[model samples]
Target: MVSLRAIVEDETTLLNALSLTIPEREELASITHPAQRIEWLACRLAVRRLVEAQGVPYAGLQKDEFGKPHLIDSPWHISLSHTTGWAAAVLHRSRPVGIDIEPIRDQFRRVVPRVLSDKEITHAASDLNRLAVYWCAKEALYKLYGKRQLTFRDHLHIEPFADHEDQLVGHVRLPDHEEQLMIRCFRTGPGLLAVAY
Candidate 1:
């Protein structure tokens, strides 16, 4: 089973404890991008804490060329997500896994037409809502594919859904595989839109 949780602090004690738990913690800590550094550390901390309670060791984690995290010698699969002050991860013993979280914003409108197909945009219950769903779903699919050549519009497609204020459903279509994805959108704080995949 996989669990998700939100970390609200940037304390070193928590970060160090997480580094000690995950096998690839040292590697993640080496990341220098300010945003990446914070998220990588926070996510590592959350995943380690969750798996350790189940008797899993942090040293069992590894990452791919795209920097997606996975279990080292163990067979379990893992995925990480972080947005602003929050971080989350999922662990499953079977199947390849991917997860993403984003802070939603109006800026998505500027990029929506580039990624969404005409059919998808038409099906969007509202213009703003459509773009938000499209952005998050594409991000999730990108994380799953774990490759650089894929373009959100040319390579990925998402089906539109009836928009509610807080949740939406869509299907992510890739060149090789198609899967249904669920996106939950809500305000996490002032001026922040959060999407979890």
Candidate 2:
């Protein structure tokens, strides 16, 4: 089973509603920036909700050297993503998962070279939102890969698809591994949400 949740951040209620245990509080205490603090809390809360729904007590989360988050002493896989005012989490009983939340921006074009191949750019064509879809789909796939080393332009590939489609498949190729990821996209207010597994 896979559980997903996304919520717009409310700074006022975030702290009041979140009753983080001492360890979880310590994990985020170093974050001085308000935005970062909010995102961190929102993600933990989302994950907390998922685990609670599944009748599992919430454990603290930790990260590996690659910064992929894992629930302490739990076998379930988790992925998190957030922007300034939104956060999302995905929990999977067995399969690995990835989720990303991104705000569409005109500046995304400037970073196209770093994130997309020539063919991908051609596939996105002149439209900007389609570019957002490609960028977001790739971001989700990158998170799905979990490791920190892969390059979006080199290791990730997004097959062409309509911007209106509910889902898309992403490809990953490495010297030692290959995977086909199923990614789903949705309109999240002003930004985009992509989840993969």
Candidate 3:
């Protein structure tokens, strides 16, 4: 099970109202881009919101060797993604998960050959926003897959589907393990948000 939380503030707003722990503040301080810092701030705030709402006291967070974030004192799994105007986080107490948010853009067209398989291209419905949604799905799946060596074109694939649903399925084909993933994307004001688990 995956639980999602999102906030619609831009990075500047989050920085102005920053409420992060010392370590999280240090992490934000290390980010060079103002916008990137904002994304990081938004994600941490969203996670705190989720944790507080769940009746758990927000604790510190830690990173695994891969730099994936997790609670320092809890068993819940976490994944986060942030874009220009939004930040999102996913929590699953029992399993790994991933989440991403991206604006609908024609940019996916330039990377179609690199990110989508032939089947996925056909599945993308020839629309830029649809393509972005599919692209975000593959990305969420990749984060859930957790290894950095993945090539979206060859290793990640989404089954063909109508573009009208809030949910879709993706496949990860590694040399040793092939699995189906459940993914969902939603319109977030000006962007698309996707989650996989």
Top model by lDDT, which number? 2
Tell me, by TM-score, which candidate is best: 2
Tell how far residue 129 is off in model 2, in angstroms. 0.8
The digit string of per-residue lDDT tens for model 1 on 85-126 reads: 667666656655555666667787777678777777677634
Q: TM-scores of the models, in the given order?
A: 0.74, 0.89, 0.87
Query: Candidate 3 local accuracy as lDDT?
Result: 0.79
TM-score of 3: 0.87
Model 3 Cα lDDT, one tens digit per residue, 41-81: 77777777777778998785777777778876899888888
**Candidate 2 per-residue C-alpha lDDT over 8-49 given as tens digits, one digit per residue, 9 for 90 to 100:** 646667777677767667877888898888888888888878
Which residue window of length 10 is worst by lDDT in model 3?
Answer: 1-10
Residue 109 in candidate 2, Cα distance off native in Å: 0.8
lDDT of each: 0.62, 0.82, 0.79
RMSD for each of the candidates: 3.8, 2.3, 2.6
Residue 41 Cα positional deviation in candidate 1, in Å, after optimal superposition: 0.7
Evaluation by lDDT, superior candidate among 2 and 3: 2
Q: Which residue pairs show backbone clashes in model 1? A: 21-58, 22-58, 23-58, 23-59, 104-193
Q: Compute the lDDT of residue 119 as modeled in candidate 2.
A: 90
